[model samples]
Target: MEIPQIPINEKERLEALQRLEILDTPAEKAYDDITLIAAEISKMPIVLINLIDKNRQWAKAAFGINFCESDRKHSICAHVINNPNEITEYKNITEVKEFDKNPLLEKLNPKINYYCGIPIVNKENLALGTLCVIDHKPNQLSDAQKTSLQALAQQVMLLFELRKKNSSLTKAKEELHKQNELLKNFAGTVSHDMKMPLSNMILTIDLLKAQYDKQLDFQGKKHLDYIKQASFTLSDYISSILTHYETDKIADKNNVEEIDVNHLLEEVIDLFHIQEECEINFIEENPVIKVNKIALEQIFINLIGNSLKYNDKNKIIISLNFSKDQHYYYFSVTDNGVGIPEDKKDSIFDLFSIATSVDRNGRKGNGIGLSTVKKLVEGLGGKITVESREGQETSFKFSIQKYSQKKTA
Candidate 1:
């Protein structure tokens, strides 16, 4: 038997085949179904979805056959890959001189005489192997059958491509998960280390202020105050970073509970010492929502805090309202604050976006709160959006799916 010569691009072809990771895999129904259809269409008793490896042709799918593999020197599939785009057919293998000593033909129990193979060529024009059919009697395929066989070969190539893509995506997801874990650990470590030093600094400053209260000049007291404020700001920034990283770890869960919107808002408001000048109103009747309570609390805290933080009005008028549709509960936090600029609206929800206007106290924003809120909302299967007119009123609207107890349970 004459051994089939390897293609000029044999090295690259073998690399591509290995990357597919299909060699020696257990039979899959996707490939078996194609071979079964091809067998039915061609009226052939034996059919195979072959993959040509470096030294052998492996059967990914086989019908009417027991063996899973064969040597390349004895494989007709190896010959088909050399002229991959064309179908190779032998009406009677015994009549062909080159295949006269072919081991496969000599070993057939029924003394197989007919063979046909359509090469499974990928988009790169490298044939991996073939979709082949064999018969025990001299036979010929009709033009339609040959066309259908070639189409099935293409389907086999498509399956290979899909398998490679899915494997790549799975690897990427695993890598991303590892990276996120590392980041979470890093954030926790840094936050803890930095907080200790900050606490010591704050304690030292307060002790110095108390001991030197009457002895200190105005400038000395003012500089000390500045240090205390700066330390507090740094503390806030670190806290925000810790919160953001922590939110990243909140996986989706079916932890839904009925929560009174009015009571939740009242608790969030109490957490922040609202300015006497700020006129915060819960406008309409609030709906009792079935939701992840922690996520809902986070949404209100950030939105209401921002409304109070960014306002330019003498009396910051903030209105909270809620409405609902069949699928979602829509909540709006509208504020007569210095509204979000049209250009900055899209990016305000992004991490570290410092799109702020001066509040009553003239404090600038650190820009982590809104992003944390966005993450929490999305984690609970909700979406948030903003509507604003520059220098007028800005409204932040968000929707969360009303939880169905039966569906979740």
Candidate 2:
């Protein structure tokens, strides 16, 4: 009898098979043990777990067999997949002209009389292989035997899915571990490189001030004062770098608690004593957020200090405002300062990227402040933006996730 050809779209079937990634693999006991159990339960002389590849039948497990493969044109399991969830039974493969004439079957000890096969599927709904039982004498599978074989096929599919999921999860964990190590190494290297030069500058400035204490002429005294100021500026720069590093650590977002916004802003304003000359206008009502306090302080200091840094006016007008809508709390800080240039606006938040020099008080910084602010905001799942028009004014608008009223004291 000639087996009718099952018209299947090869591309679709192969694509489905590829998703499982189980082609041409070594034998797994999950598939092997099911074959053995089926053979013992059914009292069959031979059992095979066959995987139908493109051109061959590959046995994942075989009992009482020497050969590992046979031509696909003569595989009983190939037909088994066409009727999934049901076993295909051929009482005699020898009577089937296609399989009987095959070399492997002709050499069979009991002449390969009966065949039963069930297809194994992975998560992608692909029949990657088959669980089969064979017999030398013609036999029919009982209803109980058929049900048991089907359940065993499901177990084989579950094992394949579990292995695939485990493999993917292991790879992701490894990649994350590698990334964390890189961040730690970079933090260590940057600390060492920055501290050495800062230490030398402080020591040299101290010596210069002592040497010029009493015997210095007017011009010499002026030069010494200049050296002292420059040394102090360098010290501030080193401090800024260290602050940036600390900001990164706390910004991990694990220590978020109910923080009072009004109180925090007042503390920052008082620390700077901006009330003396600089008027701080508040458009804020009481508000609170779940955020790391140190990181929030770092953000406030960097931004407020930035406003004071490049101010052209003797008395600066700074404004603070807050509002809530839906899930986000918005904050804006506007200042009458020397505005940023339109072309270099976007680069202002980049580390070591200074747009134009000369802050409000003519003091310079190491230029990592805005970059640190960006990193901190992102760590807390927030966003920030800056707007400026010529040398007239500049404003920073930012938003953060707010703590619910119940969570606030």
Candidate 3:
């Protein structure tokens, strides 16, 4: 039989194999046991768990085999990895071109006359390795044996998938750690750079007030007041930035607690000094949820503050409602505000994305508020959605998972 040379997706295939992390390790009894069972079931003396590496074939489990590995130049298993969809059978290897010059046939054990190998693949459709049974005699495996071997090959594929998933999760965790570190560093740098200039400006303003107050006319006092207002606005902007940074930091920590959502909303409303202006209504029978309290508070604060700031009417109507799906609890903050445009609604949650407005009032939005809410909801494996028009009603609907009740004494 002629051995066909196939072009593999080498980069993806190698990455898939490495992601399994099963190469060059101590023997696993689970896999070894499978091979042992295959040997018994197939009536073959030699059964091996073989991985196709860059230039070598490595064994994770082997039965009735003295050698742990051999060169991929002459490996039947290497060919099997490339053709994962089907099992490869060889009555003899001497006819195959890839194996004709190999030391395994001449200098090494020439006893291996028959081969049956099955490919092990990951969920990504990348073939990683193979499981095979070999015999000294030619054409040893029966149809039943081939069926059992194929079944066992599926088990091996499952093991590879489990390993690959674990590897991916580990990589993701490491990336998150690195990103959090960068955020912390950025926060430190921004705090120093921004605060110093603001401090200097404040000091200069005080000096100007003392030096020019007595000599100045009413116009000068108005100019001084304008400078003071600008300074205060800058200070508020800085505070907003700091608030954004803290929101991210809190979300990263994910400190969840049992919070009274009603009380929390009330607190935010009171803090806004709009406890009277805004008609705040909530379903108060059991408005409790397990959430990162600070994040939840921030969500309410942002939603309500936006309503109060943007609404043209003297009295703003804000309502908090809750519902439950099979997997999560949904919270909706509905309001009558200067609603967002339909075209720009999709980008509302993007960082530094401001609402398109003809008049951006003294509200001084940092634009990170909605983004923070988005991240927090996603981090908690939840979702957020918005519905709004340009000048009508606006509603923010978000969901969070229902926490399992822990048994307490």
Candidate 4:
């Protein structure tokens, strides 16, 4: 028998086939189901979802077949893929002189005489293989049956496309995971290596100003202050980065405990050391919660800290309230501070996105705290949103799901 001639774009066709990564895979139920349906609809005894490889016709799914594969030289599928867009049918293979000498003829138990192969073409217009029907008797498929067969072939190609896409998505996930790991490492390195030096620089600037206050001119003092501010900004930036990176590790059972909200609020209030006429209130009847206390503390700290820092008012009034439903505990932190602008509200929780507002000390924000708070809130299986009236007040409302509890006896 004459060997099937390769297409002019044989290299491209083979590359496309290999890209599918379906060659020699074990039979899948999805493909087998199609073959079975094709067999039933077309009244063919055997149906195959064949994939044409460089050296073989691999049957990924077969309805009535025992053999797994056959040599490419013996594949009628090779002939169907040659035209790429048309279905090839032989009413009687023995009557067709073209396939009379093929080696597959002698290997068939029932002496197969009829064949129809539909090209399984992909989006790239390359025919990877065929969905073929085989019979020993001289037979012909009706027009509707022929259409169904072709549609089934398309389904086969769709399955191939899906497999390729899922593989791509899996690879992307792995790559993303690797990137996150690297970023975590980089953040850690910056935190450890740069924090101390920045602190030292700020301290040196302070000492220089204090010791040489009389001798230093206006420009000299300004330069020292600039250095100190720069150091503080960089140090804050590094700290934010570290906190953001560490957020993923904080949402777990390790920190979950029975926490008293009153005590927690007291600690959070003390953190800011406001020596001004400021009021921070958290009044909850059921003050205790079984949850990730540390994560909750971080969320509260960031919000309250923002309330204190961004305020232009003489009296910073911060109110905190908590309520619980069956599934979640909701909290609201409202502050009479310099509220977020309407235009900037949408992106306030995005990393490195700033509203360009200076704090009470005239220090521009590092724009990391809100994003970290959002992460922490969502990590606890809840959502957070902000509502603000630019000059009047800003409120952060967030929910965290209740922790799973074992049923007590």
Candidate 5:
């Protein structure tokens, strides 16, 4: 009996098949379903997704057989992958001269009578395998049956391609996660080293002013104050940078706590000592929620601080509202502030992107706060948005989920 001849591009074809990462893997219902459909359409009892490996025909999915593989010399599907572009059919081929002495004729106890297989090809146009059906009894495939089998074979190729793509995406995500961890470590070390010297400078400036208070001129005093302010600003910038990198870890699942949101808002307000004539109001639905408490507080602090720092009204009027439904809590913070320009509103949450350039206090923003706030909010399964009328007021609306949607256990 003649053995199946290897394809001319056997080396490249084997590489392409291996790249799919599918050979010898356990059965998948997706591939099994195709074999079942092929069997039913052809009125055959045995069906298989046979992958042609170097020395064997391995079954990825077998419908009516328990065996998984056989030597390439005994595999009829091995011959089918050779053409790489067409279906091979043997209908009572044993009665024909060429296959009269074929070993496939005695492949089964009852003697194999009919066999058909369509090639499984990849993006490089290399045939990798076959979706084939076998029957021990004589059978003739109809035009409709052949078309359906060919379609099922194409579906098998699509599954292979999809699996390769998903595997690639998973690798990319893992690599990105590793890179982010390294960056967070570097930022933390640098910020700590930088802040120590800045802290010393700030203390030295304050000490110099107090020790020589009687001798220093107005210009000398002003210069000392400027140096102190610059030191503080730089320190703040370093802290903000560290916070941005560490924000991703802040919304940890273990950080979740039951909180009275009204009290939480009060805590965030205390973070800002607003000496201005300001009226802060909230409907205070008293919605106690279970979520990452620190993350929510971080979100509230940025929004409230922005309102206070950007306002121009004599009485800084800020209002807050909170309500919740079956699945989520909704909130809105509105303020009489030097509102954001229309053009900058959409990109206001982007890191290092500012709306009005400077706050009412005339301090230029580092543009890190709002973006960090957004990351914190989303980490807790929430979304935030803003709307404003320049010279009037700005309103920030956001929603938080009642529970963490990502909890797997």
Candidate 6:
């Protein structure tokens, strides 16, 4: 028997087949179902969804057959792949000199006599395999049977393409996860190493100011103060980097618990040492909801701190309100602080984005707090937004999932 000639694009064809990663895989119902239908439509007792490997034709799905594979030289599907544009049909193998003495035909239980194969060609025109049917007696397929078999071959190619796409996506996601983990570890190490030197520098500046209180000129003291402030800002920036990287880990480790809104707000306010002159009011009763305590605390601390830092009014007015629906709890923090400009509002939540260089108190901030708050809010499956009129008032609104027993589990 004559061996099939390889296609001109044999190298690329083999590469595409290997990339699919489908050879020798367990039989799937999706593929098996196609083979069953193909057999039924063609009135053939045997059908196969074959993948032409480098040296063998492997059956991905077979109907009315037990053999899993056969040599490429004896596989009709292998020959069909070379002329992918047309189906290969043999009314009777015995009349074909090249295939009459084929070992597969000689060994068939019912003495194989008829064959038809439709090449499984991908989008790039690379023939990977075939959807083939065989009969025990000499026969020719009707025009409709040929069309149906070709259509089924296209379906087989689509399944292969889809599986490859899904595999690629899964690999990409895993790589991204690995890269994020590395970044977090790097940020933590760098932040920890930096804190000591910054603290030492601040302490040294304090000592200089105290020891030479009268001897130092006004400009010298002012420069030293600036150095202290800049150093502190740098320290805060490093801390923010650590927080941004570690927030996901913290969320994973913590347990969700029912939290009293009033008590939580009180604790957050106390942590910020809210100025006594500032008028802080909860407009309505805070509802108890299940949430990650640490994430909630971090969100409020940043929002409230921003409100207090950016307010120009003699008596800053801050209001907290809450509402809820079946799916989520919505909260708002309103303040008479310097509002964000229309242009700046879009990117205000981005990392290191500062809408204004100087806050109301004339202190420069590192512009990491709002970004951190946004990350924390999103991690808890929530969204945050802002409404503001420039130089008037700013209100921050956010939503978080309402607690459910299934969610905790």
Choose the strongest candidate by TM-score: 1
- Residue 382, model 5: lDDT of 79
What residue pairs are clashing in model 6?
A: none
Where model 4 places Cα greater than 4 Å from the true spot, the runs are 202-229, 405-409
Query: 1-409, model 5: which lDDT tens digit per residue?
Result: 5688889989999998888899878778898888888878988998988899999889899988776888788788888888878888988656645455655456656677778888988867788989888888767888899889888888999999898899899999999999988888898999999998999999999899999999999999999999999898889888888878878788675677898888888888888987989899966567777888877887788799899998888899999998888888888999999999989988999988888877887888888888988887787677999989999999999887777557687
Model 4, 1-409: lDDT tens digits are 6678888888899999998888878778999999999999989999988888889888889888786889999888887889988889999888887687788888789788899999999888888889999998999989999998888899899899898899999999999999989988988996989988988889888899999999999999999988888988898789888888889888664468998987888888888788879887777575688889889988998999888888889998999999999999999999998889999999999998887568888888888999999999989999999999998999999999898867898
For each candidate in the order shown, give its overall lDDT on alpha carbons: 0.86, 0.75, 0.76, 0.88, 0.85, 0.88
Model 2 pairs whose backbones collide: 309-359, 309-360, 310-360
lDDT tens digits, residue span 141-198, model 6? 9999999999999999999889889989999999999998888788899899999999
lDDT of 4: 0.88
lDDT of predicted model 5:
0.85
Q: Model 4 TM-score?
A: 0.89
Residue clash pairs of candidate 3:
none
Instruction: Give a tens-digit lDDT track for model 3, residues 119-183.
Output: 87666777778888888777657788888888898898887667668878999999999997788
lDDT of 6 at 83: 91
Clashes of each: 0, 3, 0, 0, 0, 0
TM-score of each: 0.92, 0.56, 0.66, 0.89, 0.87, 0.89
Q: Give the Å shift of residue 134 in candidate 3.
A: 1.0
Give the lowest summed-lDDT range of ten residues in model 4: 279-288
Task: Name the runs in model 6 displaced over 4 angstroms.
Answer: 24-29, 252-254, 275-277, 312-315, 406-409
TM-score of 2: 0.56
Residue 371 of model 3 has an lDDT of 80
Error of 1 at 290 (Å): 3.3
